[model samples]
Target: MSIEVRSLSKRYGRTWAVRNLSFEVQPGRVTGFLGPNGAGKSTTMRSIVGLDRPTSGEALIGGKRYAQQPAPLREVGTLLDAKSAHRSRRAVDHLRTVAATHGISRARIEEVIGITGLESVATRRAGAFSLGMAQRLGIAVALLGDPHTLILDEPVNGLDPEGVTWIRELLGSLAAEGRTVFLSSHLLAELALVAEQVVIIGRGELIADAPIAALTAETERVRVRTGQLEQLLRLLAADGVQATSLTPDTADIVGLPVDDMARRAAASGIVLLEIAPIHRTLEEAYSELTREAVEYRAGLTEQDAS
Candidate 1:
């Protein structure tokens, strides 16, 4: 199954949460839905699963709107909010209740409980469960119908390191099985590890939609270290290449390949100690991309202010 959001828009009173956003999430891959706080990630996901109606355009699963499906849960499972379940209900009872509505058997519910690692807490009231447990329960509920597509919002919000790894492996396996997996999270590094494609939005507008490799390749830099760093810097400056001095002997050069830098240095009689490309991490890439789009930004410290 594939998800397509075409010219989708959402509004809350006078504010537009998502405006003219469009993207395609292909099957057999994990697509990371990324944005800064209040950038409308949740709003877009909610609209996709029919929890919130779009103000304009459409969000379709397999070329049809979510509500048009006769068996919605069996087609697309969603974990929009971890706490959407009744707090007083036991974990097992909660899944069973949701399954009953779809006529899903109890055996399938148990399988999902085990799949989500919620077997130990199956009989516990949701209110008494920790946030991590609650997240697991929510995932179990989403997987109850054995859906072909999964949409999750901040699925790792309160997980421990082990639980985080577990979720990562599980998502990868699901996508390997040719299921469509779309998720949003604040953990950019973790997203980089799992997501093959990324869809980034800023201020409710589409900013970037591309493969992870392509996005990171756009920010690649060459790091050069030499005793003649100043001479190399001057040479690079004259060539219109952007460079940043990291240390007295090391400089980071952008818009220039490592081999080209080394050749230039050798031509200038500048002996090179080290030269290599520095690949930007997903966190760095995200910070740079959304720097201007962030809704809330922290102020500089007192020392910096001084």
Candidate 2:
């Protein structure tokens, strides 16, 4: 299954929650939806699942709108928020009710319950369950109907390291089976590891929609520490490379590969203390993108006033 959001826009009076945002989530891959807080991530997801109507445009699943689908649950399994289910109901019972809606068998429900590792607390009331347990239960409910597309919003919240790992594996396997896995979370590090593509939004507009490798290509920054740090800096500077000195003997060089830096250093007889590639973490990449946007927005505001 695939999702195509075409010029989707949603508004609340004078404020636009999402504005002409467009992207596609391909089947058999995990597409990460990312942005800062209040960046329309949740709003775009809610609109996609038909929880909220878009002011214009459409979020289509496999060529049909979500509402137009004969059986939405059978086509798309969504875990929008942990608070969507009844807190007092047992996890199994919660899934049963959903299964009943689709005329699904009880045996299938049990299978999903076990698959999500909810069998241990299958009978426990959700109100008393831990947040991680509740998240698992939520996932079980999403999987009940055996939908081809899974849309999860902040699914890793409150999960332990083990639980997080389990969820990650489950999603990867699902995608490997040719299902569409579109998920949103603040956990950029985990997303970087799992997602093949990313759709980043900010202030109701799509900022970037690209493969993980492309978005992270700039993240391959290398730092070189050498005895002749000043000489190495001057050598690299001739090529218009900006090198920053962190210490008397340490100069952090970015925008170039470690091997190239080493070659340049050796050509100048610059003895090295340490030369290693410093990959910018996912956190750093995300922060850099959002920070640049913030500065751009600030400049726009100033220009408008002037």
Candidate achieving the largest TM-score: 2
CA lDDT scores, all candidates in order: 0.89, 0.83
Give candidate 1 regions above 4 Å deviation. 234-238, 263-271, 299-306
Tens-place lDDT digits, model 1, residues 1-306:
899999999999999999999999999999999988779898898889888898998999999899898888898889988998798999999998999989999999989988988888899999999889999999998898899999999999999999999999999999999999999988989999999999999989998999888878764599888999999899888778898899999988898778888888899899999999999787877888888888866673322100
Candidate 2 per-residue lDDT, tens place, 267-300, comes to: 8788888988876666676777777444235334
CA lDDT, candidate 1, residue 41:
91
Error of 2 at 258 (Å): 2.6
